[model samples]
Target: MSMRSPYPDVEIPEVSLTEFLFADGFGDRADAPAFLDGTTGDQLTFTEFHGLVEKIAGGLAARGIGKGDVVALFAPNLPQWAALFHGILRANATVTSANSMYTGGELAHQLTDSGATTLITVSPFLDRALAGATEAGLSADAVLTIDKAEGHDSLADLVSSGAPAPELTTTADDTAVLPYSSGTTGLAKGVILTHRNLVANLLQVHVMGSVTDQTKIMAFLPFFHIYGMTVMMNQGLHTRATVVTMPKFDLEQFLSITQKYAVDRLYIAPPVAVALAKHPIVDSYDLSCVKTIFSGAAPLDGELGRAVAKRLNCTVLQGYGMTELSPVSHCMPDDRGDLDLNSSGFALPNIECKLVDPESGKEVGVGERGELWVKGPNVMVGYLNNSDATDATKDADGYLHTGDIAVVDDEGVYSIVDRVKELIKYKGYQVPPAELEALLLTHDKIADTAVIGVKDAEGEEVPKAFVVKQASGADLTEDDVMAFVAEKVAPHKKVRVVEFIEQIPKSASGKILRKDLRARETEQA
Candidate 1:
């Protein structure tokens, strides 16, 4: 006999403008610290967390940002990032996440795209965020500030002056959050996650993982990303677990926080995993209590995983997800009885996973490689302004086709073999050459470069580079650029062809336009 859902037909929960997550955990633990901002030593107990959200929501309600209105959060991973985000949803309104590092041009695009009427930002980034908002012709009705909104009325002040949240009703299908993602072929598109979608995914993780009251987790990941929003912030809130947060991924700060909080569960990305595996500063921290380190966002090399586990003596479970699946469809928890490296684990309790041919819509046979498709309450409602894109990704049969190519083994372990869209196809085999190109561009006297797949001697495709050199100081040659990239990317993905260009075109969201590069090469050929 196997365990199953009590309400199989029941859907995910939506934003109901009344109950706070902290109160849902327990009234007794209401005063328990939910977030500790390691940067400022500021901590918010569950009582304060709920109270602030109520006040913020009340204030927002006063401003007429009710159901369906969008609010933007352009702040770091400080304690207030959560309050404002959850508060916006509490009013049955929508939320759009923006990176604090975005330039005015970048920020304006998203603000206008989301039609966000309210812009909530921290003080340090206020000037840039406000400039962008103003340039976008968006003067937020409620300009709430975090710790330092340029001497403006802080979120704290608004929460204090406003009344408690008024009861409002909502359904599970109601849209709650709008987090953006750079899809397979386009710029960043808003991922509209309904309350049910988010709640369902979190519930899946809650059901599978062993998050007890004793759970002391580290929250260094940005609050903007779906992975951190659901797993670190939301998951910790409901479980009555204490989460120590770091606004930025500073190795020294991370070390200090672990010592301060005696952190247990660590969640990080591949880049951070590199630091854990190779950096010497980590040895200074007492990580004996650390039971698990969950890695995701990008692929983690099996070698790096082993190195970190050997050094830290903690099981590193690499989870897999995209912004579309409410951020997580599978969890390879460290305590997973018998899971191997590179295996992203199987579908969580309520999810249905399948494989489909990338070129055709037909489902592939078992053990065959194909696009990983997912179906569950956690799947997003749709892309905000692109119905065609939404329909293309999500099939009529209800499965959302992830552009990632993977093979599921008989043991239920899912390992991503390749990213179909992110690939730089050379000959026939694809190459993921990202940091390799960035490193090449950074070599002495090189200005900028973009490595793309192009035809070679045997009429087989190989990597080619378009490099722009610094005009003033150095006379950089095409050979110099090729050698730089050759040292980094694999032989097949090495720059066999090189051309001088004035600029390497990129999308608005900063991703390189490899298709445009391929077209340029064909034009030259």
Candidate 2:
């Protein structure tokens, strides 16, 4: 039987995202701070952020970028990124976010796949952005550099022209953002999230007391990731909260900024919580101002989460979701005295979830371990350009097959047990072996490679590569294989273990025999 959220259904506004955010009487003070640059202390008030969004929207419109146009936003967390993202939406264009750490080839795949005609990136990531734009058949003029520099125009230049805002022509069902995800299988594909999906999720989370004007959020999570895009940046803006932006995560910098800004709400991953629970440096900083720590992106060790909360004297909570579910479906309540730290909390206000036997495809009883299926307004419209994948993931009945094995207790709280998919989770980031294997095949030394996740010394799942080297590359060491992949992908996705094999186990249909390798790994352990 399906379980509904304990809270009553909320009335979601049918307006556009920008309209919802800039609506009248949303916040008490329009001049109050909305965002701040953690490094430079640069600030944008609510009123200013709104006007700049309009100006940038106008600018993009003036440049012939409007409804149905696709723009790629590649940047780290920054104060202006909020404005830039909303501006793209205000122009009624879809913004596909590319991870800032992506190589030119990686970024190019997204640009070409998403059909993004325009690329916006900061000065640091300009080289890859330009190369990606070229590879995607875009001209240099199509690249808009965020930093105002010679030869390249910046976001400032676009906003300075002061073009009038273009008319918004979009339906709630139109795709707004195309964040890529490697759905239960295969390579990364664009998750088609409509405007309604995003707004519904924001409201669902808001009704749960996740964010408000009193929330002083620290935006350290990469905005390129959907969790940061919706939870920290969008929710912070929708509530008119003060968000302190960090370009990247550096433990020292994180503590310094959080303390300096008196940040009350921290949207973090489990790794950060682990550090706070065990790291000695955490005691050096006074974190008394912090009230709530919302952890997502991966499973949190209940003991570790509670330990961190005890040390900081704050409420540490865990939530669960994926890119396909608008990134948030279950979250712990703010008052956490009665909830289980291991549970992912109750389903959000409009979401319904069920535990179903994977093999039987029948609904499971309470406390039974089965794959989790969720149905909600926040579910993605579909996978872009891939109807087969869309059909495989979301059923005609609208329930999304989440591939995650979970169990619900008598109280209706859910706990994720394992993933039925081959994707590896390195500190909460999805690392698809298919994507990595495809990249590894291009390496000169590699003849064949099959990647799988193995538990590291830290009890974390990391990509381990079983490789077949070319005769000429017999001297290739494990370090060589690791470095070869490290240069191409993000840090968390780097190969941690390497094993040389003469033949790769596979089926007659050419599917990787991962079960055989997993059994071998179990024997070795």
Best prediction by TM-score:
2
Candidate 1 regions exceeding 4 Å error are 1-25, 140-142, 423-525
Q: How high is each candidate's TM-score?
A: 0.81, 0.97
> Model 2, range 385-458, lDDT digits (tens) per residue?
99999999999989999999999988778899988888888988889999889988888888998999998887
Model 1 lDDT at residue 472: 55
Cα RMSD to the true fold for all candidates: 7.9, 1.4
Q: List lDDT for all candidates, in order.
A: 0.74, 0.89
Query: Mind giving the per-residue lDDT tens digits that candidate 1 earns over 201-221?
Result: 877777657887678888878
Instruction: Candidate 2: list runs displaced more than 4 Å.
Output: 25-27, 471-473
